[model samples]
Target: MPTDPQAYRPATALLTLGEGFFDPVAPADFPETHLRFRNQRAAAEIGVDPLTDEEWIRHFGRFDPLPDTLPAPLALRYHGHQFRSYNPDIGDGRGFTFAQLHDASGRLMDLGTKGSGTTPYSRSGDGRLTLKGGVREILATEMLQALNVPTSRTLSLIESGEALARGDEPSPTRSAVLVRLSHSHVRIGTFQRLAYEQDESAMRRLIGYVLHNLYGEDGDDPIRLLDLVVARTATLAARYMAAGFVHGVLNSDNINVTGESFDYGPWRFAPTWDPAFTAAYFDYQGLYAFGRQPEAIHWDVMQLAVSLRLLVDTEPLIAALDRFAPLYGEAVTQAILWRLGVMPGDPDADRSLVQAVERALRDTEVPIDRFFFDAFGGRLPDAYGTGWTEVRDALAGRTARGERVHPYWSGAPCSMLIDEVEAIWARIDQDDDWSALDAKVAAIRAMGDALA
Candidate 1:
């Protein structure tokens, strides 16, 4: 890991696409800075893991655009469906794509910020992020990554030394700035905004840019793009189910074009198999509930298909949209075995094993997370429950035997339960103690490393 933050000058690849996609923006000045977290693993991607905390604040907190990074931060513009309603006045209101750099594998990665400052899209809101919100997102991404979900990583989080009054969770919450590293910041809403404005030319350009830069396809064949995105989205939905995560908002703006999950806001990992479990408090209708996620995602993809109509014929796009259900089903079946640490020997047998596992867990009322932790590597506990006989028989085909799993799995599983999260924050708020938060993150990362 390089010790200096300025070692790599990112390509700022998105800037090459041109004027209509984004607007230049700067970060808000904070009263003080305390570097809270730095993802060393993520830093190794761009070779900046060795930077000192002071250097971290200088580059990430001071809002000094690195001379080698993006020339200037750009607040991307896009519109989206908010709660299934068309909202044209939405964009990067509180954050911007700070820079883009190539990872060790040569995939272009974006360094984006949240709670940076106000922009043209900040209609009536203060563009500040609560410290609690920052902590929540860090946990969300870490837990999702541990469960093998395609997601972003929190690169840096710094307390901005400002207390803010907010109506949501708590008043006078501390403020923060968060940096996340992801494959792309371009969203489905990007196309929606272009289509809504009747900018077919920009739409075509954007499509080609996404395909070429992100997908490694040279030409803008919109049909092929649709199929790729559809397949990825299907697997994405399956990943969420296997992980028991409810991604509060399935809006077009929150759905990345790359289909990797990011922009976490009231995300939660289900403690049980409750389908109607909703993550966000305001989702009264349960539209984006755990069970409705697949439906909501399919609907969002249709809107994306609608935008692609400007360039491609309707039949092919429709055909791509039709693949989601089957693909999602197949992916979930395979993911079940993967999570169980089995090699998935036979397709039909794998499906049967998954069905058996689900039936057993649902019948016994065993927590989904606990089942996975206990039965990891195909080891069933000696003590049998109501469904263990069948579960044991089904797992017999699991040829999983001795394998190297981290010691963390042998102990109590680290969970992202909301009560536990609130307790961690309570210590910080009441006694200014940060050890609990630090230990939680460390345990989460250890689990992720074991999964890898």
Candidate 2:
């Protein structure tokens, strides 16, 4: 429990909430989103105490008045196609952005949550998110951040007191609230809903609001707004590909209008080179597979364009859509080169090297996480020549009867930037200093930045 709740603040509170958006619905409902994992380390960086169960209830048990200057973050109305059918009555049902806060890094980020409770948008059933879902989100966010992907950061996961009935899992496991920090939570469906309702005034207002708040509009021209959204969406998509991440659901409702990645559900990185990988349990048709992510993003951009018809010229919107492939390609190339510790040059060699590594990896089928963590250092077992004979011997799978296996033993292909990744087999075969390996990765990253 935090002794002073005022010590922590959401990103929304950093600046005055802009005008006329009705405040987020009251947090009167006592729907319990459980306390599971509080990212205390990350929260500490933002000066927030991830409270315990007893503490959470004691502190944030009732709704607190958001600063009066900021517009109440009214749940933006939206409609979208789920799995391909148009569902008109969907929006933020349980969670809302209570406020925004500035972190130690000085970034003004939105502090929002899920499974907080029902809202005016809660249609027919209980508006709750599962505890397991919270766990998966934490795992996904941690891995994606490590890979340097642009993603919403999870601040804390709290287990709620009430039980939730979910068909996918056991009856009444528990509910949870995941506090997230992101640039914005506005979605494409927000525009779509207004457009569908022919609420052209609100749509225009929202676009102008987004531009002023997110992109820093220099003038009042709406075309500039379209250009910003298009460019941001393209860059975001490219980063997603470069990180080998597949956002399983790119629904209009889930696609943040600000072009930031949000709603972390059903996401996975490519363990191998297969483009067909999907992290969503129900994506049976591979709608949002790794290979299709770029196209999916473009599709989402198109949906935004359709909704933007009220505000921007159709010709410019079409032209912006055309920029998706090239922009995404360039972003992906740059990101991959950065990750591999190499500059983007000689496309032919890069292609060949990547293909070879992919083939090796497919053959080895080792865990990707362990592969990178193991060979972060430039030195490899074979690099030291005959001095590494014991390392070589151990790599050959002949060891003392009671000898323990090395941490990096998983068979896998090394990245092309690894000058001597081949030496990993022998290096791990010998006792290796993990801290030394970490320093090596840091050095490589620094070198990559210098080259950049």
Candidate 1 lDDT tens digits, 1-452? 23445435367679778978999987898999988888988898876777777777887887666556688889999999999899999999999887788787878889899998898889897888998889889889988888888999999999998888898867888999999999999899998998899888898788898898899888778888888889888888988988889999999999987889999898888887778889989999999998789889889999999988877789989999999999988998877777787777778877888888877766776788888877878878887566778778888757763364678776887678889988988988888798998899889888767665
Which regions of candidate 2 fall more than 4 Å away from where they truly are? Answer: 1-24, 28-35, 44-73, 103-107, 345-452
Native-to-model Cα distance after best TM-score fit, residue 56 in candidate 1, in Å: 1.3
Worst 10 residues of 1 by lDDT: 1-10
Q: lDDT per residue, candidate 2, 1-452, as tens digits?
A: 34225445444432332333333676545545334455665667555565555665433333343343234444545688676667887877877776666556655567677766678788875766676576557655654555566678777676666677888767766566677877777777777777788776777677766766666564445566666777777777776765667778888788775677878766666765466888688999998887777788778778878877877679988887787777776666555545443444566544443444334444555444333333232112344343333323322322122211332233333222222322421242245322433333444333323223
Q: Report the Cα lDDT for residue 102, model 2.
A: 57
Candidate 1: deviation at residue 187, Å? Answer: 0.5
Which has the greatest lDDT? 1
Show where candidate 1 strays beyond 4 Å.
1-9, 401-405
Give the TM-score (vs. native) of candidate 2. Answer: 0.73
Per-candidate TM-scores read 0.96, 0.73
